[model samples]
Target: MHFLTHNTAPCDSTFSPLYSVVFGCILALGLPLNAVSLWTLLRHHSLKSPSAVFMVNLAVSDLLLVVSLPMRVYYYATGTWPLGNLVCNLITMLFHNNIRSSAFFITFISVDRLLAVVYPLRSRHLRTSSNAWKAAALVWLLVLVINIPESMHFSKFLKELNGSSCFPKTPHRSPLHYIQPVLMFSMLAVNMVCTALVSWTLSRRLNDSARVNNKVNVMLIFFLNLVMFIICFLPLSVGILSTNIHVRPLICLASVNCCLDPLLYYFCLDAFWKKKEDVDLPGEQQLKDIRSPCVGLE
Candidate 1:
């Protein structure tokens, strides 16, 4: 619970310590690693490839989320929404947009890799750094547009009822309750489908030994996200129908997402972070040999 979550102030001396510790840990891990990921992708990798370009933007999205966490930390500690409406709106927008962008871009990254492995020659034409940038820009623009209604929907002040500041105190008759779940689940479904397709394509390309290793590593990341997406989202999406408006379950699930998110990101694209020089395994020697000609062309 946050210190300043309105409706009911999220400030129990008992729980505040736990919340502080969690956010502090996330701030520590997300900032440095996201910074390094940003640098490695920008300066150390071949951005000529779309996957590399998308990876750079993905790191950027995560870093943006990381940057905003401190505000939440402050809010949790002080138990105040002192930032006002404008800052709160920007914070909300940034958080949601980053979330949408991350999920979509992960799918895009998977597709990029699948395309490269499945149809190298044809895919090469469509995969360029500049084009990747355009796609990334489009994602931000679209997600921002999708989230615009949210900014309008949220209220910074309640009518003396001591309600939540970040969320509106509008009547239950308002449409946002339905709209929010629909939007979230739609995005989730799109991501799941895209990931499945990519996984299938990639699996087809892997030889027996490579297949086993890839399944172990890649599925570890993918399925964890899939599982969490289901369990965490169930309350936010499905519990709307239930009369019990218990926010604690949803809050707990949401925190799980944040805590596990770093691990998911680490493994999902960790292979790309490895430079050409990092390998010693004989299994991947075949891949290097196959790509040596393309490497030389660079």
Candidate 2:
């Protein structure tokens, strides 16, 4: 069912300008955002919520992709991969790992927020930082195990006709190829469900003004995450389903997710709304005063 030829010609020179622009933008934006996110998460001890932990891991995944961009940019700039087989394979591996790992971590963030809103009392005990760390660890392990073989075999996918292209050129079918489409859609389904449920639950709490504001804040944060998920992944997912479409550009577009992730940090970790409100309302002030004496911070 591989409709596209495996050994497609070397990418046209016309495409290199687009690739260079895209890769350059990703590099310029993704690195500093991820770096600042990593720094802020580590420095601010108050930022260690369950969802924040997932954001931290997401930043890590984005940083990996950012670090690998220069080589990709160079390849596009020259219209070839002169970096030899090992570097090419490793770069391909980074791209593969970054996308899936980002998806899984964002999934965790969505579910974590959904549980918090849906089962507030239970979520207090259930959503611990230790558990978040454990979950993040498991995601890394799973992604690495699933991706390592494909990455190691990336060199085999290349053909040296016009020049060495890292993208696969043969029309042969493989289990990984089949599994990828399934995985993309499966994760996408979970994200869409979680987003819908979280939004619905938050909408119901709008009657309680005090809780309403907080719920709205959390809901908006989740909404940002959901929007990013669709913006980054939906096209790639669609391309996978429609096998005739060349997916490399969509893949590059998806990488922009890492850059947008820092927006979540600003919204969630920085307490943007809370700071702006600054306990301006009497009810909010009273609530803050009441909660201020508590042993644990939210």
Deviation in angstroms for 114 in model 1?
2.7
Q: Against the hidden reference, what TM-scores do the models get?
A: 0.70, 0.78
lDDT of 2 by residue, 1-298 (tens): 2323222435433226577778989999999989988876666544446776787789999999999998777766655666677777677778778878888887787777666655555556667778889999998998888776775455555544333565432232335656765676777778678767756665655445644655555567556666666777666655655546666677787888888878766655433223221211233332233221010123
Alpha-carbon lDDT, every model: 0.56, 0.65
Where in model 2 is the C-alpha error above 4 Å? 1-15, 46-48, 159-163, 167-174, 206-223, 241-243, 272-297
Best by lDDT: 2
In model 2, what lDDT does residue 251 have? 72
Tens-place lDDT digits, model 1, residues 1-298: 4424442553322224355566667778778877876776556565666766676777777778778777666655554566666776676567656656666675566566545544555655566667778999998888777765666654423323243343222222124446656656775676566566555654666667756766566567567657656765545555544454644335445434444445544564544445544221133442333221111112
- Best candidate according to TM-score: 2
Candidate 2 Cα deviation (angstroms), residue 189: 3.1
lDDT for predicted candidate 1 compared with the true structure: 0.56
Each prediction's number of clashing residue pairs: 1, 1
Q: How close is candidate 2 to the true structure, as a TM-score?
A: 0.78
